[model samples]
Target: MTLSEKILARASGRDQVRPGEIVTCKVDLAMMHDSGGPRRVAPYLERLGAKIWDPSKVVIASDHFVPPPDVDSAEILALTRRFAREHEIESFYDMQGICHVVLQEHAHVLPGMFAVGGDSHSPSGGAVGAFMVGIGATEMAGVLVTGEIWVRVPESWLIEWHGQLGEGLAAKDIMLFLCAKLGMSNDYKVMQYAGSAVTALSMMERLVLCNMSAELGAKTGIIAPDAWTLAALREGGHEVGDDALRWQSDAGARYERHLEFDAGALAPQVAAPHSPANSAPVAEHGGVRIDQAYIGACTGAKLSDLHMAASVLKGRKVAKGVRLLIAPASTLTTREAAADGTLATLVEAGAIMLPSGCGACAGYGAGVLADGDVCIASTARNFKGRMGSPGALVYLASPYTVAASAVRGTIGDPRDLLAMKAAA
Candidate 1:
């Protein structure tokens, strides 16, 4: 069986399972944010008068709509707080970070666990070798009450990214390249990344691949547990032990498809407005002017991601007309970046640091584009009205490309800037 199949089989108390088989699995954890947590599921839980099956297994964060800008937003946060207290949810992370980042930062999700989140990027947990997926508010309410949910086993796709990634490239570029090659309509499919380039990536970089799997329309994404995965888990205070390595895909694991790519030949990629599938080489989009350059969201503003942007922006200034807004993935990221001077580099280069939250990525918190604005962001999606007015254009790129483009005030390749910096 594949790693995903093995996880499902274990979670469901089955010896083994096949693709398309429906199985009822006990959820190891359920995560939610202010936008989709208590406010949306509370009424339903009340209607049924059901208590959470296990409060300790639940994690909540106030990310979207945090630091409320309006009365309604404030009330939602209030309700989120009230619900957390009422249920004695000890894992609630309010205004500290996005739901996905907060959960993993606290090591709430572990390898071989079957987890579900209210946010689509829940698959980010798979970076740690967990089988995690997103469910809607209604379904999440059920998980909260019963601690169990049904899932149809999904076919696995093995994407092997071999060789070495070029300078200024990252896991985001690899994902955008895949988004174009594999259009975002993959239902009931799991994207499991592997090979030299993928395994060589930092855990945060690996998380980017899994986090963006949702953009491919995949059910979830995963990577086999390795020394790096175990080390990261241990650093986060999880003693998964050597036994967690058993969660890997078997030698003869069954996968519906196995695709391979040469990381050396890959270029920085950018996705055009309204669709991540519109991705192409950064060189193809050169000279497309942008009004704003944003680095935020769980996918893009992690500590490593901030360092990526700072590497490009150091000693350089953002274009005069461009607004560079950065909201670190979490407050913890902000502190880490600040300690290492990455935050200073960004602010010195004209970045305006917004509070750590979903921010413009969710079209909430701050930095939402105005009508007619053109922006390049490090967030996962560029769908219409996702970051602001429908009339605004949002291009998606990596932190390297976004920071380089911010300096250029147009879509430009980060490699060019890096090369120049090296020569200087």
Candidate 2:
């Protein structure tokens, strides 16, 4: 079996598996956040009529409402702590960072392992070569008791991206591009990315890509194991096993569908309006006009993304009427950016630095938009009312483009800024 097949087999608990077989496997790790964990686990206790089967394998964090924004949130955090203490769950992260980011940094979730979480972005662990899935609360309860899950091997779809993405293009742009091209309503099918472009991206980039598959309604997105992936795992303190380091797609590997993407020809894309799939080329749209610009989230909070935002805002202020909110991915990332003066650069440009948490992106705390407001953001998901009032509009773009737009207070293209800056 290929690596993908092997992973599916292991997760499904089958001795030998072929494509298209349905099976059930025990979950190696289970994670939850404050918002969902309390609700999910509370009901589980009620349903199970007993304590959790094992607490060590379960990890819970309150990153969503970290620094709890309201009285209600504080109560939720209090309950989460109570439950964690009672369950003796070995791993519990406070509201210090994004759940997905902390999962890799402190939790050491690994590849060839099956992990499930209440949050849709749990597949972020796939970057470390794990077969991760995101499910609802009830599903999580079952895992909490049995430590096992049932899965149907999804029919795979191969998406090949070739050539170099032109200047100012980033992984987020590719996701917006695909989301629009594929149509959100019909993209729930399984999606996998490969080809030269996939090999060219860094681990963070791959994570950014797979992270957004949920926006397209995919079961979970994954990239075949490779050396870059292995090195990234090592950096995160996950030891790679010989058999665990694997790849998929044998000769004549069957795919439900095959789509080719030309990275070079693809311009930076923006998912306009309320839906991420309603995309248009940055230039073609003239400018969607934004009252606020955001440069942080699980998708764009990495060190490289910070560097990109800082460079664009280095000597310029955020344009009149536009506000940019920047949040680092983790406490470690915050420290690294501050030490390198990247955080200073962002603040110097008039961008507001929030705590190292999900914050506004998930609409749990600050940064909510008012009715009729327009925002250009780098976070995942642009579904209607995702950020705040449904009347508000959001356009999804790359970090560079987001920075550039903040500098201009409109939907400006980053390539144009780069060209003008180079000439100056």
Question: Which predicted model would earn the best TM-score?
Answer: 1
Scored by lDDT, model 2 comes in at 0.79
Clashing pairs for model 1 are none
TM-score of 2: 0.94
Tens digit per residue, CA lDDT, model 1, 269-387: 99998899999999999999999999999999999899999889998999999999999999999999989999999999999999989998989879998889999999999999999
The parts of candidate 1 lying over 4 Å away from their true place are: none
Which ranges of candidate 2 are over 4 A from the true structure? 15-20, 186-188
User: How does each model score on lDDT?
Assistant: 0.94, 0.79
Give the worst 10-residue stretch by lDDT in candidate 1: 98-107
Question: Per-residue lDDT for 1-424 in model 2, tens only?
Answer: 4445567776776765665667787788889988888655786677669667778888887778778878888888899998888789868888667888878776367767778888988877776667678888888888888878877776667888999888788888888988888876533355778878878888778888778888877777777777777777777776776555545656777777889989999887887877888888888655567899876678878777787787788878999888899888778788889999999999999999888778778887678889999998888877788789999888888888899999988887888787777788
User: Each candidate's TM vs. the true structure?
Assistant: 0.99, 0.94
RMSD of each: 0.8, 1.9
